[model samples]
Target: MTLSTTDSVATAGTAASEQPRPEYPRPDLDRSARWLNLNGTWHFEAEDADSTITVPFAWETTASGVNRAWLERGVYRRELSVPMEWEGSRVVLCFGAVHHRAVVRIDGSLVGEHTGGYESFEFDVTDFVVPGILSELTVEVEAPADKRAIPHGKQRSIPRDDYDGVSFTPTSGIWQTVWLEARGRTYARAVALRGDSLTGFDVVVEAAGDTPADAVVVARVLGTGETVELRTDPTGRAAGRIEIDAPRLWSPADPHLYRVEVTVGEGESADTVIVTSGLRSIQARGEQLFLNGERLYLRGVLDQGYWPETGLTAPDADALRHDIALARDLGYTLVRKHLKYEEPIWLHEADRTGMLVWAEPACPSRFSAEAAAAFEAQLPALVERDGNHPSIVIWGLYNEEWGLDWDIPGSDARARAAEHAYETMRALDDTRPIVENSGWSHVRTDLVDWHYYEPDLAEWKRAVAAMAEGTQDEFPVRLGPDFVVDKSYYASDAFPRSGVPILNSEYGEGFTSLERAWHLRWETQELRRHDRFAGYVYTEFADVEHEAAGLLTADRRAKEWGGLVPADVNADTVIVVDLIPLRAGADILPPAEPFPLVAHVSHHGTSPATVRLHAAWLRAGAPADGQAAVAARAQPQSSTPRIAVNPFELSAGLELTVPAAPLGGRLMVWATDEEGDLVARTFIDAAEVEEPNRRGARSDG
Candidate 1:
């Protein structure tokens, strides 16, 4: 029988008599079958000493119940009884993920060992297991995160550890679901499905067996009240072209998914696995990213997969889906899963929820040729595992100057390694965007990206403005202290890449500090609340413990700035007329121009009239004469007023109307109550008022 334990297991107290912790191994690919959870009461101990540790969570984590220091290496022992029904072809022991190193043995016989903290590994246990007998399984896991030369991205080094909440927070032991799979002599090993809008999708399936059996790939597009099916060849490589005329694109608003089912084996003995996919293409047309053919904007958030209690492991499927849904609700179309790679379930939930993902490969701190290769080698496994999910649109190889020793003697060696990594990933799946390195160092790339976190908002805004003006590559000198606005500067040269798709990738860690009432004293956290409004967006959504950066609070509370920015005087908070073209004063305009612009304005907190543009005025000019300004007394009573013009003599051919101005008027129209109390306003041409000025600049003055 598989071992088991209670939901919460500790390392010190529980005896070996207790059962395994988690009973089921595979959470994603689940089938109605009898299995055992090898968690619970196991003979566990810290790496070197004889002291016992917990079964699942590492000794250091609170969930593990040990709360003791585990020095790099750890040993765990457990026993299981194999049923008589398993006296068959093959029995595989799978470990979801075992920190930095792992070795497995059954009935005192060595089976297999693996080194890698993020990926899963399995060993063939058929030979070691005695039929109809209790099999004693012992796994020795050596995960020295800080000292080890493994890809433990952001997992703090031992002893002098800082738990500021980033990625890979000492998640040791069997973090994922591990199980024994009883397979037939011939079984499907792995499969990959890649899709794009232009060329048809390809379905490649691989199996392990003595004979070559035909495999059929059947694809069904689900949406628009119909499911379209396409059949592919089972022998060798099979593909089908699904020409979608007007494909329904998947975004935060509309997350559409398609399912492709593959059947392995000849007839009755065949097994089917469903691959969910999305038919979309991401390409840089100049500097803008086009989804389908429209320019795409990525309102993204940095999702560093971490939980206060669970650390790396998610509580359940709903826990994974909750983040995606929250992001969508917060108006973010994309989530840059910063630094670390997430579980397959998170990506799957993203696919179903319609959130775009920029999947970054975990990176190491030090630079070495061999280390790069190891990273490169792990790419195929990662891509193959996550390629089918439509949510993952881009694969981020390296992040923020990690291991870029371009200044060192063998700099080109590292560059070549990076190039190889990039090319190898492209070779596997060219459908999505791949970055050799995300920021700082760049070579051949689909998009340019950078990270900045300065408290001055102006620096970030200046960078954004310069990028909007098509700046690329060059770093501008910092503006004076007076110009600095916010505390962080994470802007990149994405504007030049604007013709291609661009991304803000990272931003919004520092939010306004607000206070929540606590007892007699006021307890203040790093809560993000815009002064003009509170409880709108939020702060520390992800509990970035030390970083103090997030759109949500540590305990998942809406710390202000949570909901949609309510309507107010400002453009973000307020709503004004949707004026397409505000006609110049003297020029004979379209019938729509001379009409009174009406808007169903909404409010945030203040009344409509209270939101007014101070020193607001209207100006009108003539085509014949140069220009003229109209100074009208504030019509406090009327929300919609017809501003009569200073009639020019040329009003005869101009339909006896107002003169045109080189620039449009800045009107202060009062949207008030019956008692002339300013409730709201119509800030005439507040946004992009200079657009008309730029257009007029080209005129022969």
Candidate 2:
């Protein structure tokens, strides 16, 4: 029933307030249709910004109805008239978001300015417009045309950034919905809501305009139909708390939410907003993460939030929901909204579908007082806008020492900036775990995490085991031949830990899709073999531009994994086949004699699971398909019913005999539940030697 980009937006004189995305832009603070969607066609200008481009889609993307090569600056202009029905009320213009910096003007008069491209900003235009007259609205956007530092995130540009090939297309101009909403002359300017077990829900309201001395704030929980009321101050600021009977706890298995409606005043002048919150507690008490009093293992993937057609913006609202659904389908419990602070609609969907999220901001490429300030300044707005969602359990800051210049250990100023960011976020909200400098050197943090990409399977297992045991502290990360040696230390010298919960935030490698699938089992098994790890996020959820290290392509289509589903490797329970390489760190099993079949079984289920290990031999036609890595997901020529059946435990050295075929067959091993569902699997070539998928994917200087 959906159409292509041609029908995504209206053209020319079709200026109806209702755009393609008719839903309220801010679902978290839903005021229904008090807002008119201004996301359609807008007059655009720049060498690259087209004469006319579709709203909410970046100019770089084809969905914007423009063919832009480079995007650094863009000017957007449009004219709109207020609805005749709304006369005496205030008119507010809201930008879902614009990149880097936005300077807004009304009728050539300066209205307001906003920095940071990932968070929403608004301007009240009550005095600037006549109720029924058309007014000209213009917005000027600027990103790094040269090397002027800004939190660019994974956005790659010729001059602004060269974060390997990992980064993708830039998002410039108006990439999100722009709209105008009617509000009371006196309205709630801000609503800060938080939900937890201790307090059912707490909301603080900051109102605008003059308010009666006897004005009151009232909040009601729609689920339980419970309510709370508080008297407002003369300045129209009020705080209210609501507790419902038999509150339902929220979890990934069941994300029960408490939909709420908050009122600021009384009668016709009353201002009301709708938001959703959930009661849950997440803590890293021991060497594990607990969600709602239950232990959790975060099987997460790094989602870059880019698309081939729309670049950084979603082509449609369904696209946002699809990513979450795809991750869930791949047997992942969480999605790390990598680098970019993803759109609010994505978080809203995560709340409804019960998926965990790690929210982050775009990091400036270089470091300075300006860069640090710019980077940290967006935290409050980021938290204030998205904190109510139950899906965002972790707040991640800094990825692989990006904004800090990859020198946190050598510079105290950089380290202090990292610490200050953590402290500032703590001051804003202490409910979620904040990673000071995620996957780099943690000067201060609630969780100790790392990102190591090693292609050698043998070395990878050793490194993962050692790190999990708290032995390997230094992980050398060489950005390129031009950069100095940068090692991601387990912890900074100033903040040594007896050990906090460890998560491998970014890790995985593969030369080809088949090889990636083949090595996926090894890499996943290596991490899961260590019980100390809280979880891991694969290098990516989908490929971005040329950075082809994802299970899925940029278009959300599944990358060919040699007939293997990603869920096969990314599962809660896995059978980690333990075998000595024929040579050093190889994937071939010699055809000399019968090798001892051993497996280290790791299960994450609450109660033990009844499972069986199965072994088989697959004969290939030639040495072509199984040339490098092991052939995976190919039907076995013959099957061994069950090698061992045991209650799920870390059992190793299970007795079995697996002979390498003399002519040309590989040895296959796997684990299955009592019902014969594949939970874990891996294979070893019996004929050819293995080749490693080396890291340092790019060698660009």
Predicted structure with the largest lDDT when compared to the true one: 2
TM-score of 2: 0.88
What's the count of clashing pairs in each model shown?
74, 1
Q: Which stretches of candidate 2 lie over 4 Å from their true place?
A: 1-22, 47-50, 69-72, 157-164, 210-214, 482-486, 580-586, 590-593, 618-649, 666-668, 672-685, 690-701
Weakest ten-residue segment in model 2 by summed lDDT? 1-10
lDDT of each: 0.50, 0.75
Predicted candidate 2: what Cα RMSD to the true structure? Answer: 5.7
TM-scores of the candidates in the order shown:
0.67, 0.88
- Sliding window of 10 residues with minimal summed lDDT for model 1: 517-526
Model 1 clashing-pair count: 74
lDDT of 2 at 330: 85
Candidate 1: segments with Cα more than 4 A from true spot: 1-41, 48-56, 82-90, 130-132, 145-148, 158-169, 197-201, 209-252, 267-269, 405-410, 471-500, 509-541, 562-701
